[model samples]
Target: MPNAELPQAKRQKMANKTIGTHNGTFHCDEALATFVLKQTDEYSDADVVRSRDPAVLDTCDIVVDVGAVYDAEKKRFDHHQRGFTDVHYGLEIIAKRLGTALDDPKVQYVWLKLYRDFIEAIDAIDNGISQYDSDVPARYRSRTDLSSRVATLNPRWNEPTGAQILDARFQDASALTGKEFFQALDYYRDSWLPAADLVKDLITSSKQSADPSGRILVFEQFAPWKEHLFEIEADENVPSVEPNQAIYVLYPDEAGGNWRVQAVPVSPSSFESRKSLPEAWRGIRDDELSKLTGIDGCIFVHASGFIGGNKTKEGALSMAKKALEL
Candidate 1:
């Protein structure tokens, strides 16, 4: 058989397509990152890399910056729509857009590559030289007596947060280091929320092996939604799925303690693809989502289905089949 039997990652298109994805380097919350991981590969990464560099969002197809949904001062997701901006919720709307784009498989896989860049960036930064210095404030505000009469507004200066702000006035962190640190902020944005490559590798690797029976499939870390124990509480009816549709599955993660799934978004690099998901995912996208929701976040396989060595394609598939039995 032609290499057509290969995984999406090893596909000719994946090799042929060489999109330069941006790195992850912005402030985001866990909800946004968690939301992206469970989605399709292509869409998930597009959103992630953008989290690093949001300027790309406008160029992205599956995900778009529709604007804010809540207010921080108001302390709510939607402060009566009487809001200015809720950075948290604004990102979420964009995340939803990525999920909606799965209707096309081509778009989904393309977005997968973008998501890989995001994951790599996050891993790099989280492990980089940046430190949580308890010596300075994440930012600061001060006013200098520049004029008279109607005192002009003092420009607020921004910088990283750290513990230094608590003491050492002589050092003047602003002049000395010209920076600060925000551990809470960075942790939420990079390490927790963004999509990572490990997830994508699982999806891509599992597709290359043989399945003569075609009755089984392997997923690195898909969240099965159809068998959700709490799904009944949320929605009782289990929707019928398309045969060509890919299955979404969930696994136990030290990061996400609860059930969840991630998807990809559309971006300039992946905008062209909006066709089908991968074969392991049923090779059906675009208009295939309506029936595929049930697979959104389910860990259907039993413990017995799990096989170690997930690094290998065959090994990952073994675990996927084991997950199915659960």
Candidate 2:
């Protein structure tokens, strides 16, 4: 066989680019910002130079989190100016670098997803914004967040903080943030985006079926539906009023040959449901559940009524339908 079958390391790209940022203890924002720049074709293999010297920064192709400038035409992205208000400063640059128009639906989805999930926190922390409205004590201390973990790569407060030491640590910080950034990007682009389309199809099909309420959705197959459900409903101008909003979702359970009916939450990230399975059916199971709900092939309704199981898709749909009537 040819040597082509052998596993090999990723080939390094030609070094024809330069990315500049301030030289000092690195933060998650600049570390991630630099990683985002390196992902673009123009800077994919760029050399990263950390410095605050105007002369040194001037020679670089792009500067971020430094230079006290915010000119995109000149490739400067700094947020430290007197009145900079663009929290999406980093995203704008990334989109521009990748030649993606902000108005494109897919671009908009991924941009918002990335910002909401991680980048927003980085921007907040860097800008000295509080995470909570009040100064209440946190329930738990989290040293494992990306920002906190990135900060660990910097030299200890008691340790040496030389330029060489800090720069080397910055490389490590960039790698740390880069790994998480691309993973999230890949997930949002490949998995989350596709789920939206799947949910949209399910939503459209649900209306044409026997159900007149249009509040119960039955998926042909399982997909992450929550995030897309609310958005799709709003896009379709479905009123948030009862019988118009989605109350439950029915889909086949992968583990068993049974089916599941899940209550749609009040919001995507919320635990509160718009309408739970049914108070009477809560925690009931087997034949008793079927007897109470007058639905056959019942398995169980969860204690919280968020979900219930049935032996078949029809049974699950029947459960969702009955819940709607109640």
Candidate 3:
């Protein structure tokens, strides 16, 4: 069993800090900010104060989303003021003060990475920035999200916005935001970061084992490779790694007990693959696919030729090897 006393020290340290944000109504940004602060060692156990009173806010060790000030040294992180941009401004200040280099991959990973996965939506909503431009056509619109949920938590129109009511609603808002914040943080820390190493190793090993062209990669197990593949291919600083020669990847399909050969996209976000399956094979399947490709156990090739499958590992490898020749 784990030691019961383990969190006592952390709790004691957290008890000394205070987080202040505005009272009455709440938004996703402040709620998320509160949650992110509590996850850090400096404010894990900090008392949360929801009040707009300047005197109350003045007593807080940190203020977020409510304060007009954007001072990092003073620990005020609000983006509402004129000339204020993204949350990165304040985070960059904190990062520098902590002696983390601006150029460090880990630092860049935290700031730039979380922007997409976690922070960007909050920033966009808070700043009134529309994700899509005005000219973009929309078939439907939706409002079920952190911001809408937080807005719902506020007192109904008939209900009074008293201190007790506001505080209760604030608690609910913080819980919603905190849950998502911790989930995203843990996902990045536990899953995404570790996968980078596995991907790099695969890339290196694949290059070594491939034919002299170094264009094909064979994976023993299926993994999320697109993002890591793009990162590795573009990374020029790595000593032994060559840039962007891979054209396809071969792996096993988990659900069907078959094997897959997928084309490598030029970039992670791009739909255009570097080298798709042969044109003759597209949208063909089963015995016809087998006869056309001269490969046994053939399954199907996607209409776009980006992917194809086979009933055996050897068949998939054969398909990929043949595609390479095309």
lDDT string for model 2 (1-326, tens) is 43454444322433357899998889998999888877666777788989999999999999889998987778887877665555434455445534577566677767777888878888788888889999889998888889999988999999988999998899899899988987787787678878988887777788788465668888989998887887876764545323337788998898898999999998889888989988999999999999998889999999999999999999998898888878
Evaluated with lDDT, which candidate comes out highest?
Answer: 2
Model-by-model lDDT, in order? 0.31, 0.82, 0.80
- Alpha-carbon RMSD, candidate 2: 7.0
* Poorest stretch of ten by lDDT in candidate 2: 6-15
With a 3 Å backbone cut-off (N, CA, C), the pairs that clash in candidate 2 are none
Question: Between prediction 1 and prediction 2, which has the larger lDDT?
Answer: 2
TM-score of 3: 0.84
**For candidate 1, lDDT tens digit of each residue in 58-137?**
33333322223343443223212445222333233323444434355323433333334333333333234233557677
TM-score per model over all chains: 0.20, 0.84, 0.84
**Which window of ten consecutive residues has the lowest lDDT sum in model 3?**
88-97
| Ranking of predictions according to lDDT | 2, 3, 1
Candidate 1 backbone clash number: 67
RMSD of 1: 23.1
Q: Which stretches in model 1 have alpha-carbon errors above 4 Å?
A: 1-181, 188-190, 193-195, 210-326
lDDT of model 3 at residue 310?
Answer: 97
